[model samples]
Structures are given as C-alpha cells and as structure tokens.
Target: MSTQPRTAVVIGGGITGLATAALLAREGLEVTVLEKQPETGGRAGSWETGGFRFDTGPSWYLMPEVFDHFFRLLGTSAAEQLQLVKLDPGYRVLFEGQTGPVDIAATREENIALFDSLEPGAGQRLEEYLESSEEVYAMAKKRFLYSTFASFLPLLRPDVLRRGPRLARLLLEPLSSFVAKRFTDPRIRQILGYPAVFLGSSPFTTPSMYHLMSRLDLADGVLYPMGGFHRIVSVIGDLAQAEGARVITGAEVTSIRTEVSGRKTRATGVQYRSPDGTLESLDADLVVSAADLHHTETELLPLELQTYPEKYWQRRVPGPGGLLLHLGVQGTLPQLQHHTLLFTEDWKANFEKIFGKDTSVPDPASLYVCRPSATDPDAAPEGHENLFVLVPVPSDPSLGAGGIDGAGDPRIEKMADAVIAQISSWAGIPDLAERIIIRRTVGPQDFVTDLNSWRGTLLGPAHILKQSAFFRGSNASRKVDGLLYAGGSTLPGIGLPMCLISAELILKRLRGDTGTEALPEPAPWSATADSRPESAGRAAGGDAKPLPAEPSSGDGA
Candidate 1:
C-alpha cells in the first residue's frame, strides 16, 4: 500500500462538484475539479449586465436545515458563509380569478389564518397537514435523503419495517391528491401542491413524500442569500480552494478512463478539453462526475462500463424543462413581493399542458417570479427591480434558446410576450413589459447546450412514484468499481439542498461508511489543511449508531 494521499478527479464545477471537491480535499484526498464553463455554478449559472445581477437557476431556498447541516460539516455555517434574510411574507400568490393576491405569511399562525379565510374551518386542517408533513420530513432526512440505498435489506430493520407501510402509502399517493384530501379550497390545494414544481415535478405526478417541502416555506420560512444563489457558488468555490482542492474551469471532461479486470470495471481518471482547447487526460484513483447523470453515464463512459446507458433512460420520465426569463426592470414595482407565483385559473389545464400527454407550453402560463431586489437593494439600481421568472415548458430541446431584447426563437419570444401580458393583467403591473431594460431567456434547449441536461430536463428525472427516494438512481457505478456520482439527477432527488446531500453521500461512499454514523466535528488541528474549514463533512448530527438496512436502486449506477 502507498502512503501518498489518494487522488480524485471531480467532473463539473456546479454546486455538487464544488461541494464534493471541498469535502474530499478536507478529508485529505488530493482532489481536482473540472468545469467546462468560464465559471462554476453549472446550471445555477449567473449573469451580470447593466449593473443587474441575476441567478439564472434555483431561486427558492426552502430547506434551511440542509444548508445548516452542509456548512456545519465543513467547519462553517450558512449564517457565516452567506447573509441569510428570512422573507416575511415568504411569497405572494396571484390566482387568476381571485380579486386579491394571498401572501404566505412569515408566521405559521398568520398562514393558518390566511387559509382559514379562504375556506371555512380550514385553519385547524392546515395545522394537521403541516404536522404530518414535518413528520415525513424528519423521517426522510434520517432514512431516505442521506441514504445511498446500497442494499434493500435495510428495509427489514425494525424501525423501517414498522414504517414501511406508511412510507409506501406516502409514496403511492400523488401530492395533489394528498393535498386535496386535507384542503377543500382550490387556492389552498394549489398552495400546498406547488412545491412539487420546485422538484421539477407536477403536483399530480409527484409523490406525497415531497409534501415536506411545504413545511419548509410555510412553517420554517423561506430564506434568501443576499447575493442570490451565486453566493452559494462563491462560498463553495472559496472553500474548495481554501481546503486545497485544485479547481479548473473551462475544462470539459470528454470521457472517463476505465480499466477492466476479470469481471470488474474501475474508473482510472478522466480525459478533458482544457482552457487552451487542448485535449488532456488526468489519472486518478477514482472519478466522480457531478454533471448530469444521463450525460455522465451514457456519453462519458464506454457502453460496457456504463452504469446507466442511453436506452435505460428511455423508460424514465423526466421533470419539466423551463423557459427562464431574467428581466431588469427600469422602475420599482410596489405590487410584487420578494417572491411571487402567478397561477392561471385553469390550474389543471396549465399543468396538463406542461406534463400531460400533449406536453405543450401553457397559453396563460402559470409562472414563478422572484424579485430579489425587494430584499436586496444591490440586485438592481436605485429605482429598478430585478425579476427572475420561470415558466415550466416541455423538455424538448428543439424549442430553442433566447437572446437579448426581443430577439429569441419566435416561439419562445411569443410565449414570453404572452406571460408578460398575463402578469400585467393578473398581477396588476400594467407597465411590466414596457419597463424592461435588460432581458435574457434560457430555454430547455439552453439546458442541453449549457448543462448537458438530458432531454433538456432542467431538474433531471421527475420525483414520480417510480423515480423518487430509493427508486431514484444510485450514486455508485455498477459496472465501474471506483466511479461515483453526485447531483440532482441521482438519489434523494432535485433542489439545491439535495445537491448538498448528494455531496455528503459521495464522501460517505468513498469512506465505505455503510453505518449511519453522523459526520464528525472539526478536529481543531492543522494536519489536513493549508487553510480553514478543517472538518470532515459528514451526516448532519447525532451520535454514532447503527441504522436500519437501506433500500437500494439500480441505474447501472
């Protein structure tokens, strides 16, 4: 055995890649991260023009504890890395036919009252609903979310065995049906069910297991980092470098180098296109691709060594791709909150258009609008407001990308025009379209071109019954011994917080930690660092203890 630190190569410099690099470096592994873009952040890309800054992806910060846990393992805290401001009215929602928009108040009591107002005697029902959601959230964090599901035998453990039937029921029920069971009001049902979209799923198809999402914003509160999600990228980048990880941007990983011995295959390293456009290969003890799982498994590795082949993806349903509109409005808008959701009257039809058999863009699009400038002045100029809008569309890449001003694919521009006018009439911002000074649009096609998203799905595989929790893709390669994966596409499912959990899972897999021991605290020493963040990132918290056997998934990976 050699005494040298093990070398690891991480592909993609997105949140997952940066986080995995930082943690692995702190664990004393010599890690190198490769990114194709000029900067990190992958799909959570950023843009700056005319003094306006926009986070091109992932606007909502729903799960605070996940952020807290991720940072704590790395010897920092979310409070210390980024200035977190809790939004008072977490968000405002405009229902098409309703006279007044409703705010998801900062406090649960207020939210309960708001729900009660919409539907008689619904306040107590909201309480019961959130309680159940919180319970499921707790169960998932402890068992499912952080698990690799390395084996299905864990399902036989006493605790899990007892909860198996409950868990199954939760997974089997659609989130929309689950919400409808508790709330009679359409507004209330929509409010509880919309979190499914954050997972790149429709409320109608996503499992009720995801209802925990409502607990985060409704009870725990929504948070915004001062500089948008880009700050998260910055924090991870700095930490990775600080912890001695070599991060290279403008380096596109083209293939995974593998070795076959007898019946086993193991990844040796990766070949990439460097900044100078030279083809280069780097050898390593192990490889982790934080890029899209489909692209990583199908395109990067040989057919024989693949954990997930292209044909395998044919059976999986994908989450919705989106038309992202980043607008720099010239004047302040008093009507909009820091976060707002404009839902069309025909809610079912709107979702049916996006996720139904037709798979078409909705005419009167139900969209999400984030005005970070309401909370952060620096997001816009003195009298201006910056808007980050998301319109769920089909995952087909042929819809095409968008350009500056009104210069975009005719179809995209047409939809953009319709949504802008829809918000004007619905949200009561009459001058909304005219006031735009700077504009950029990112479509499903952009997701493919920029992030290598498969089928142009923005959030990867949808969290439907057969595609969520342990049923999602595994984190390790089946055919390749030393290859691993980390990102929204893999198990535990989508969202920024899930990306952080995916990183921790990578560290756990590398350590061969099958037991449910929580990650250790910082050792208050300089042995493993040339800088700060001197702790091994691990499970959130709790004393070392044995966990139930875990359920496993197969994706080749």
Candidate 2:
C-alpha cells in the first residue's frame, strides 16, 4: 500500500456518487466520478422541452437533515446553494369515492387534529405514536443509519441495548399491522401505511421500523428546492468539483480493473469508454460503484470477482418500476394541488397487481401527481401547467416493453390513456388530453435501457426485512478488496436522503471509523399563519372504513 494520497474512481454520477467523490476528495483522496449520461445528475437530471422543465426522478423532498449534513460537510449548506420552500399541507390525498381530499398538514398539531377528526381521541393516540416513532428515528440515525456492519461496536452500544426489545418488535411486526392496531379509521391506516411503499414493499411485508418516515414527514416536514428537486443534484455536483473532485460525464465504465497475487484479488481502478469513442483506463487505489448494484456485479466485474451472481439477483425482491408521464398542458389545472396522491378504493387488489403473482399494471392504479408549476411558475410557459404523473408497477423488462412481441400485455399507449383518463376524471380536467402540447412517457424499458436498472426498477431493491440494514448488501464488498458500493441498492437504503447517508456510511467503512460524524441539524420549522388550525376545514375529508385485509404486495414512489 502506498503511504501517499490515494486515488479513487466513483462509478455513476448520481447524488450518491457525487457526494462520495466530494467526501473522498475532502479526506485527501484524489477522486474522479464517471457518469454514463451526458449530464451528471443521473436520475436527478432534468430536461427542457416545449417551454417546460421537468425533473426526471426523485421529486419528493424529505429528511432535510440528511441533505443539510451532506452540504455542510462540503463547507456549505443546502440553503446557501439552493433556496428551499417548506410545503404547507405537505401533500394532498384523494381517496376513491370521497367528496373532499385529505390534506396532510405540515404542522404537528394540525396532523394531530387531522387524525382526531377521523376518530375520536385519535389525536392523542397520534401524539403517542409519533413520540415512539421519534425515539426510534433518533436511535436509528445514531446507530443503524450512520454506522455499518463493518464493526460490532454498534450492537454493544448502551442505546442499542436499551432499545433492543422495542427495536425487535418493530423489526418483526409488519407496517400494515402496526398501523391498523393503532388507528381505527381506514384513511389513517392508509396514510400511515402508504409511506412503507416508498421503501419498495407492501405494508404487509415491510417492517414497522420504516414508520420513521412518518416522523420525517409530519415532524420534520417536506421541503422543495426553489428551482426544482434537480437543483440539489447540480448543487452537490458543484460542491464536489469545488472540493477538487473531477467528474467525467458521458463516460460509461466497462470494467473495474483488478489484480491478483496468489490467493488475493484486489480492485485497482476502472476502464471506461469516453464520449469520443476511445477506451481509457484510470488507475486508483480504490473504486466505488454508486451505480445500480446489479449492473455493477453482473456486468462490470469478472465472473470470478462477482460476489452475487445472476441467480442471487433473480431471487431478490426489487422495488417497483414506474410508469411515468410528463405533460405540458396549454391551460392551468385548477383542481390539482402542488402534490397530489390519487389512491383507489381497491387498495389491496391494486398492490397485488404490482408485487403479487399477478404482477401487472393495475386496472385502477393509484397515482402520484406533481405539479411543480403550482409552486414555481417558471416551470411552465405563461398560463400553462407542467405535470409529472407516476404509477408504480412491477419491475420487469418484459412488462416494461409491453410484454413479448410488444403485444402480450398492457400496451404502453393503453396504459398511458387509462392513467390520463383517470387523472382527467378525478381532477375534473375534462379536456386534459386536448390541451397537451408536450407529452413524454417513461416505462420499465426506459429504466432498464437508460439507467441499466435491475428489471427497470425506478427505485432500487425493496426494503423487505431481509434486505434491510445489516441484511442489505454491504457498502463495502465482501468478495473483493478496494471495491465498495453506494446508492439505493446498498445499505442505509433508498431515496435521496438514504443516498446521502449511504455516502456517510461508505466514508466510515473506508476510514475504519466507528464514531458517527456530527453534521449540523436542520433549521427549525414551524407552522405559520397560512398553516392556521382548521385551514382545510375540521372534516374537510373526514371519512373512514375498516382496515382491509393485508395485501400480498404494494408499490409507491
């Protein structure tokens, strides 16, 4: 091993890779990031068309502390680089057969009241539920979220021992059962349970440890970058370069170079094809892949260097692949809010269609609609609207390409029309189709081809109990020395916040440090006059049903 500064090459230029490159450079390592795309943002990349701008992936902004911590490490903050706006009534939920929509308020009190309106005394119960959730979140951040299985010290910590019993219960119980046991109203159960979908599993299968996402929402609140969520990507990229890290876009890594002596094999660097059609090799002491985990294992490394083979990947439960539509309408949509979740009444069957044996596009699929123009007028042309609609489906390339011979199953056009019709009918925008000036559809095929994602999954692997934390793929490789992994597929799991934490964990592994990094906390947020009590009416959308039977599968963004 060299005593001088080491060089590192990071594959994939998404948030995770960029953050890792920046952190490594700050730690005195020469770092280089290679992205196959023309842009460095990966899924966070944006495009302009028809006088509108669209963020390709990851629109929701939760866990503000994670981003703030990452930026602060680069000697800056998200606030300094990108203006952030706190969303009041963070998002709206439109349930099937409901006259009014459920607006999940940003304030703790409002959320409590929102729960109480659904069932008497539910407000107090929510307070208790969140209090427990807060404890779990705090402990998780200190113990599991920031630390890796690189050491057993985490298991011996006083806090971990103290909370062991409770943590066990959380890990053992399914999120669906946990919420159903606490809240009587079906909507309350649905609201609390829906977040588990973001982790890429059915509420019935995912552990209740994920309830921390609710605290991240109700207590911490949701935020958006002033420009768009993609701005965070650019901000992080700039910070990485400012820290002396070099980022090379349009460079597709072909293989991770390795050397073997006797019984030991070690990764030394990577070989990639440049945009100018030349194959180039870069030497490094270490190589980290923040790209799709499956692609890295199956394609980038030699078969002998591969830790998890094709069969291993085949057995893994992947997160949902998305069916997305980006639209530029000639007129404004008055009925839609900045963030809207339109859920169907047959929630069980809907989920079954995604992760269950049936695994197909749901007939009456639940949808998520993001109208960035509702918050930032610059997103669209004057008097026009920009809408990004997403529907979670099974992660399968065959389904992505509309099945075999392109005629086997739900055709992309048919699916898009169904989604549009659902949105038009639900939002009361009857002429939605006619007003569309620019329309783009992204299916499973897009994910598989564009990002080389496993099964065209929008998110990474599903966070089933078996695929979480210590059980999840390690950030550091087990079979190869000097090779590591990051991103949604790796430990500390999915989403942008998780990606930032993934970077931190990777740092800990590389440095062999057991102590957690002390990043500054997020700025205090509170409800303002606009978030006054009863803003959405005492029972703006108060209605309930009994908890439905647990479904075999579920999916969400």
Candidate 3:
C-alpha cells in the first residue's frame, strides 16, 4: 500500500456517501462525490411547492448522538452546528378503534409512566426490557457494528460468547411474540412494534432484538432540526466540502471502469452522463458506492465483472414499498403531535397481505403521520402545518391484489382519501382534504424508477435470519478489489445510524485496520450470468450459503 493521498470517487451523494467522503477526506484522502439529482441528499432531498417547503423524505430524526459522533470526529458537536430541539412527547400514536391516543414522552421515566397508566405493572416491565436492550446495544456496538468482520472471530470473542445465549433468545423470538410476552396491553405491543414497520418488515417476521429501537427512543429521546432533515444533509455536505471534497450535483454516473489481467486490478475512474447529454470519464484510485447495490453491481459494473448471481436476489425478500403523501396544509391541526401512527385494527393481516401475498393497500391499514410544524414553527407558516403521511404497500407489479391498482390510478386516490378521512375524524379537523395547498405522492414504482431500489424495496434486504449481519451484502466488494459498498442495503442493515456505521466499516477495511487480508486488486468486478447459482461466481466470489444465526445484539450508537 502506498502512503500517497489516494484519490476517492463516491457514487451517489446521499447521507452515507457524503458521510463516507467527509470521513475519508478528513483522513487526508482526496475525495469527490457525484450525484444524479440537481442537488445532494438522495432520498433525504427537499423540495418547494406552492410557497411551502417539504422535507420530501426521511422526516423522523432518531438517534441524535449518531449525528453528534459524526460531527465530533471533526472536532465539533452537531448541536453546535445545527439547531436541534428534543421533542417532549417524542411522537404520538393513534390506534384504530381506540378512544385516546398514546404519546411517547422524552424521559425514560415519563415514558414508563405512560405505559404504566395503560396496564397495572407495565412500568416495571418496560424498565426491565430497556435494561436488556441496553446490553444488546452495548455488545452490538463493540463487536459487530464498529469494525469490519471478514471472519466470524470478531463476533465469537469470549465476551460475546458469554452473552450468546441471551442474544439467541432475543433473536429466535419474533418482535410480536416478544412484545406480547412483555406487556398485556395491545397498545404497548403496538408501540414496541412501530419501529419494526419502518424497517420494511412486519413485527411477526422481524426479530425481537429490534426492540432496542424503543429503548433508543426513550433513552436518547426523539429530536428535530430547526429547519428539517434537509438541514442535516446541508451541514454534512458543507463539512465534506470544507474537508476538500468536491461534490458535483446533477452528474449521473453511467459506468465504473476497471483494469484487468494483473492481480492488482484497480478502479481507473468513472464514466458519467451529464444533464446536457455529454459523456465524460474521470480517473480515480478508489471508489465507494452508496447507491443501490443492485444497480451498482448489475448496471454500473460491466457484465464481464458482475458479482453474485441474479438468483441470490430472488431468494432474498424485499420489504414493502411505501406510498407517501406530502401535503402543505392551511390551518393548524389542533391535536396532531409532531409524529403519529394511526394503527389499523388488523395489523397482522395488513402486513401478511403486503409482504407475504404481495398485495396492495388494505381496507384499514396502518398509517404514519408526521406534522413537522408541531415541533418546529419554521417547517410551516404561522398556524399552518407540513404533514408527511406514509402507508405501506406492495412492491410487486401485480396490482389490485389488495385494494390499489397502480400509481396515479383512481385506486391510489381512493386509498389516500380513506386515510385522510381517518385523520379528519381522529383529529376533529374539518375538511382536511380541502386545506391541502400542495400534494405529492410516491409509490413502489417511483421507488424503483427514481431511487433505483431493487424490486422497489424501501430499505434493503429483509432482516430475516438468513439475510441479517454478515449474510447481508459485504462492505468491501468481493468481486472488485478497490470497490466498497456503503448504504442501507449493506451490512448492519437499514436505518440512518446503521448506514453511517456501514460507511465506517468500509473505511476501516480500506485502511486495513480490521485484520482482514487485502484484495489482490483495487476494485475487481465479477463475471457471472444472471441465472448463475449462488455458489462460486466470478466478481466477489464466495459460497452463497446462509450465514448461521448468531445472537441478538444492538448496533453501533
């Protein structure tokens, strides 16, 4: 390895890409970020409509310390750079057919009290659950999340081994089972399972270990930036640029070029198609892909250098794609909190229909509503609200299986109206549909077409027993020498914090500090057919066997 300032090319300027580039640059490497959109912040992008601003994607800001750690690495605090306000009642939950709503207060004690009010001894049970979750979080941070694990030894350390039984217990139990075992009240179970939905998996399939998400909220507290999540993208973008990284917006990368033959094959640079239709190639020594892993492997890399077979993707389950409604409303929503979940009575059936049966909207489906104006006045005009509503839908093409037919079809409108009606009745807001100043919707097709997500999957591969941990896409590309993967689709699974950790893991591999042997080439591509078997393919070659089930553990904070 040379000590020279290595040239790095970051594909896709999302949070993961930007964070990776900034971290690498701060380490004295030369970095450049390329984005296809007119601006940065891939899914977290912002837009303006009818004189109002909407965050567009990723409205919730959980785990503020993750952001703080990112900034702290650069000798600054995130709060010092961005104005963050801790939400009092983190968010609200409106259960279907329930009389009153549930609020998650900031402090752990307060949140426990709220649960206690629902059941006789729920407060004590919640505390016990949280303590176990904290242990999971601590172990996950040290063993699995922070560093690269090319082999299983890192996860099999003596300390982790001692905790293995507990972890296995947590993993074997489904989230629904765990929640039910803990609390007698259905409302508490609903609260515990809320974050699992965001992972694109249902509580029935998602492991109970994910309950750490609830502890995270009650312990760390929910927060919001003064402006919006976009402000976060802007600040990180600024920090990356300050570290001498060049961010080129509106530049779409068409392909990645690699040298062949010799053992030390390396990434030369990339071929990009600009907005004006001009094709250009730039040279680089290293490449980190933060875009969709499927697109990067199948499209950007030449077929002669492809990695795993298309069949590998077939066995994996992709989570449901969401149908989003972005609205700039005209009057205040009196009872609406900063965040709310309107749970459908038949939660399990709805999930089964979407994930198992590959169907569309259910008659009474779970809905997540976010009224940013409730927390930050700047998100909307005086007495107005900026509401982002999301409902889970099937990612498959067989439309009308459940209720909706397709995007922009009458079925979509009908479903949206039904959700609006529910909100209207629950909040006692009259003519809620009429107050809309601007409306924008994104469905499964949009996720596939625009974001290039495989099978229109919202997050990445499902967090199933066979797909989690090292089973997920490896951070360092096995096919190409110099190429690395960093995003929601890779190791450590989905979520803002996990994605950031993914980037960090890739960086550690690049620096050769994780004790793994280096690839013979810089960035090697795999040459395999789409129908090839999972075992013994060209690009990042390895047996495609399912990874053994380890323990239930937390992720890096």
lDDT of 1 by residue, 13-38 (tens): 88899899888887877788888877
Writing each residue's lDDT as its tens digit, candidate 2 over 187-268 gives 8888888887788887888999988879977777778787776778767766666556777777889999999856777888
Instruction: List the global CA lDDT of all models.
Output: 0.82, 0.79, 0.72
lDDT of 3 by residue, 266-308 (tens): 5778999776879988777788889888888888986656665
Order the candidates by TM-score, highest first.
1, 2, 3
Q: Is candidate 1 or candidate 3 better by TM-score?
A: 1
Q: Which pairs of residues clash in candidate 1, taking residues 3 or more apart in a chain or in different chains?
A: 154-549, 154-550, 307-556, 519-539
Against the correct fold, how does model 3 do in TM-score? Answer: 0.88
Best by TM-score: 1
Task: Judging by lDDT against the true structure, name the best candidate.
Answer: 1
- The CA lDDT at 33 in model 1 is 87
**For every model shown, what is its TM-score relative to the native structure?**
0.93, 0.90, 0.88
Candidate 2 lDDT at 181 equals: 91
Quote model 1's TM-score.
0.93
